[model samples]
Target: MLKIDTVFYNKLLKNFKINIKYAKIKTIHKVIIGRKGKK
Candidate 1:
């Protein structure tokens, strides 16, 4: 049904957003570590 599909779509979108956020954080953390290593 349309409602069920929307629910699923919303959940997928939310998960995708969370993943992007986590990825960004990971990259930032790596950059910080790299900088510390250089020092």
Candidate 2:
């Protein structure tokens, strides 16, 4: 049971990390596209 819980926790952490990385990349993409119309 403990091992199962550990595996689940690790998977959750990995997914969280991936989401953060994706968000950062998306923000950078938006900046490059000049979404806000800034000069």
Q: Which number leads on TM-score?
A: 1
Q: Which consecutive 10 residues in model 1 have the weakest lDDT in total?
A: 1-10
Model 1 RMSD in Å is 0.3
The lDDT leader among the candidates is: 1
Error of 1 at 4 (Å): 0.5
Expressed as tens digits, the lDDT of each residue in 1-39 for candidate 1 is: 999999999999999999999999999999999999999
**C-alpha lDDT of residue 24 in model 1:** 100
Weakest lDDT window of 10 consecutive positions for candidate 2: 30-39
1-39: candidate 2 lDDT, tens digit per residue:
999999999999999999999999999999988966785
Candidate 2: list runs displaced more than 4 Å: 35-39
Per-residue error (Å), model 1, residue 20? 0.2
